[model samples]
Target: MKISSKYLCVILLCIGNTSVFGQSTFGRLKQKATGIAEKVIDKKTDELLEDKSGKKDNTRENPTEKVKKERVKKQNTVYDFQSGSTVLLKEDFLPDVTGQFPMQWYTRSKGEVVEFNDVPGKWLQLYSGTFLSPTVLLKENYTIEFDVIIDFPPNGNYPLPALKIGLYDRGNKGYILSNDYRVKNNVNIILSPYRNELRVKLKSIENNSNKIATENYILPDFTAKLGKPVHIAMDIQKERIRVWIDQEKIFDLPQTVPVSNLLNQLRLELESSNYKNSELGYYISNLCFADGSPDTRSKLLTEGKLESNSILFATNSAKIESDNQGVIKEVAAALKQDNAIRIKVIGHTDSDGTPKQNMALSQKRAESVKRELIEKYGIGENRIETLGKGDTEPVEKNMDPNEKAKNRRVEFVRL
Candidate 1:
C-alpha cells in the first residue's frame, strides 16, 4: 500500500515541525531539509543560507597583530558601554543589499555593503573618497559604537588608511556637510593609522562664534595585529565626551566640547590618499546609536516589556556575536538586580525563509538569549522561559526590507 501525495506532504510537515520543536536529537531532520531545499532554490537563496550558517563564501586576507590583540584583550575586559537604555537607531547592515549602497544612508561618493570573512554580518565598505551618513533620528546625548577594520598593506612599510568619524548638526535640507552653512556643531574623531595616533577635535558654533578644542593621543602598539578589526565606542553627554578603544580607555574629558546644541547626524569620511589601491581601505560594521538614559528596572518591570535589535546574532545561527554582547550584558545586569522577577524571552524572525526554518531559527535564538542570561549574567534559569514566535507576528509590514528587519527582534516580557 502506498500513501497519497497529500498525506506525504503532511508527514513532511510534521517531521519538519518536530525537528524544530524537539530536542537536539532531531536536529538532523532540519539539516536534511535545508540540504534538499537548497538544490531547488535560486542563487540569492543559497547566498542567504551561507550567511545564516556563519560561513563566508570567499577567501579573505589574513589580519595583523593589531586586530588579534584587540580580540584577546576584549575577553578579559567587560565593555561597560550600556548603549543608552533605549536604542534609537541600530544599523547592522543586515537589511541592506550587498554590493549596493544602503537605503537609509546617503553618500556623495561611492560606498556599498559587502560581506567580510572576518565578521558574521554585512559591512559598509567606504571607497577611496566617500562621505556617508544615515538619515535617522539623532539626539544630543547619544552613544555611538561601531567596529572598524583597516586593511593595511601586506608590507607594513606602507601608510595605512586615514579615517574621520564625525558628528554634525546639519540643520535641515542639504545632504552634504560642506553645504550646511548653519551653525554646524561638529565633533570629529580622526584616526591616523600611519602615525599611530588618534585625535578628537571639537568645532562648535556658539553665539555666532566658533570654539574649538583638540586632543591627541599616541595609539598603543598594534603593529603585530594589522588588518584585524578594532572596536570604537564614544559617549557624548551635555558637555563631556568619553571614548574607548578596545579594552583601553582613551579619554573621558568634561567640557572638552560643547554639546548644549542639538547634534543630529553621524558622518564617516574615508580617504586613502597615501595608499596605493582600494585594497588598502577600511570597513565599518555594527554601527549603533542610542540616546537618553532610561531606567532599565522601570522599563522592564513596570512597563512589562523591553525590546532591542542590538542583540547581535550570527546569520542563521544561534550563536550571539561578541561585540553585540554589551547590550545583552546590560539586560542581564538589570535582571540580576531582582531575584524575584521571572521573565519570558520571545524570539522573532523576518519572513525571509520558510515557516519551518524560521520557527527553528527563532527557537534556537530565543534559547541562546536565555542561556547567556543564565550562564554569563548569573541569572537563575528557573526564572526564565523561552518561546519562538517565528514569523507569525510582525510589528511592521514585510513589504519593505527595513520593516522586515524591525520585525526580526527579541523581546523580554515580564512573567
Candidate 2:
C-alpha cells in the first residue's frame, strides 16, 4: 500500500484542528493516519508514487529522532564585600540654625503637654539648601532613622519634595530615596537641631536582595505632629529596605547602593526647602547608631505599635563595576583594630537560573572568595563564613533585564 508523502507531512505538521490528532498516542496516531491515507490513495485519482524517471524513492517509514534537551545552565557569577561588620560611618549633625530662623515659632496655642507654654508652633522649617555630609555618614549595609517635622507644610507633599534620603553621587544619586515621599512636595520645618542617624556596616554584596518577600506600611494623611517627633526609619535586611515613619511606615525603596557604595562616601542632603512663614523652628533629637539595633524612630510615640517588621537595607539594580581593594583595606584595618571583630565573606546571586545550578555556582563563588581573603590578603580563615544564596533572593525585581543581570551578581555579606 503506497501512502503519499504529502499526506504524511500534513499529519506530522499537525495543522487544522491538530489538537484532536495530538491527543492520540504518538504510535497509534501515526499508524492510523498512514493506514487511512493508503486506503484513500488506492481508490482515489490513480496518482503514481514514483517520479517520471520510474525510480521508487527510498523514504524512511519511522518518525525522526526526538530533540535533545540540555540543562543550559546560566553564567556562573558571585559577589563579595569585605565591608566591615558595622560601619557606623560616624556622626551626622545639623548645624544649629535656630536663632535667625524666621518661622512663626510662636503661635499662641495651648501646649499638648506644656513643658514650655511656647512649644514651637505646629510647624518648623528644616535648614534648606545644600549641606553635604562633611563626610559619608552611611555604609552599604545599614539601618537608618531620623526625624523631620513639617513646620512649613507638613509630611504629605503629594510629592514629598524636600525630604529625600539616598545615595548622593555625581549623577542619579537621587534615585536612592523613597518613592512614597516622591508624591509629597511639602517640605517639613525643623525648629530645633536635626540629627541624621545611620546604623550601617558594610555588608556582603548580594544577587537577589528583596527578602523572601516584603510589604510596605503607609499612612494616608501622612502628617504626624503633636509637638512630638516625626520619624523616618529604614531597615535593610538582604536587599530590601523597609521604611517606617513614627511607628507608621510610608513606603519602601530598593537599596540604591549595592553591597558597597563604590565611593565609600554615604551622604544625605536636604532639598532647597523653606519655612511656610520663614520664621519656624523645631528640634531633631535622639540620634544614635548601634551595631544591630538602635532606638531611631520616636518609638515612644506609637506606644510600641509599629505595623510592618523593620527592613534593613535596599538593593540596587544599577549596574556598576567596582573593586573590593578599598573595602578590603578598610575591613582589614577594622579586623586588626578591633580584636573582637570577625569578618564573614558573603556572596549573592540574582533570581535567575534553576535552583540547583544557582546554588552550586553561588557556593563555588563563595569558596573562591574565601580563598581570595585568606590567600591574597592576610585575613584569618576561621573568621569567615562562606554562604551562597542562589536565585532565591533578589536585591531588586520587576526591573529591566540589565538591572536583573546586575542584581544577579554577588556581594561580600558581613556575618
Error of 1 at 337 (Å): 29
Candidate 1 lDDT over 306-341, as tens digits, reads 887667678888888762425566567568767788
Number of the top candidate by TM-score? 1
Q: Where's the lowest-lDDT run of ten residues in candidate 1?
A: 198-207
| Candidate 1, position 37, lDDT | 51
RMSD of 2: 23.3
Question: Could you give candidate 2's per-residue lDDT for residues 1-415 as a string of tens digits?
Answer: 5566876776676644566565565556667787888788675533465556754433422233211122112111111212234645433233333333322121122111112245442222334332222234443345555555444334323322233343332222233233332211111111222322212122222232321222222234433353455765555532334455555433333432344232223333344433332443333333333233222122212232211111111233222234332334334544554455554544556555667876766666666655655775667878766776776776668267766655555454334
Instruction: Name the weakest run of 10 consecutive residues (lDDT summed) in model 2.
Output: 183-192
Give the candidate number with the greatest lDDT: 1
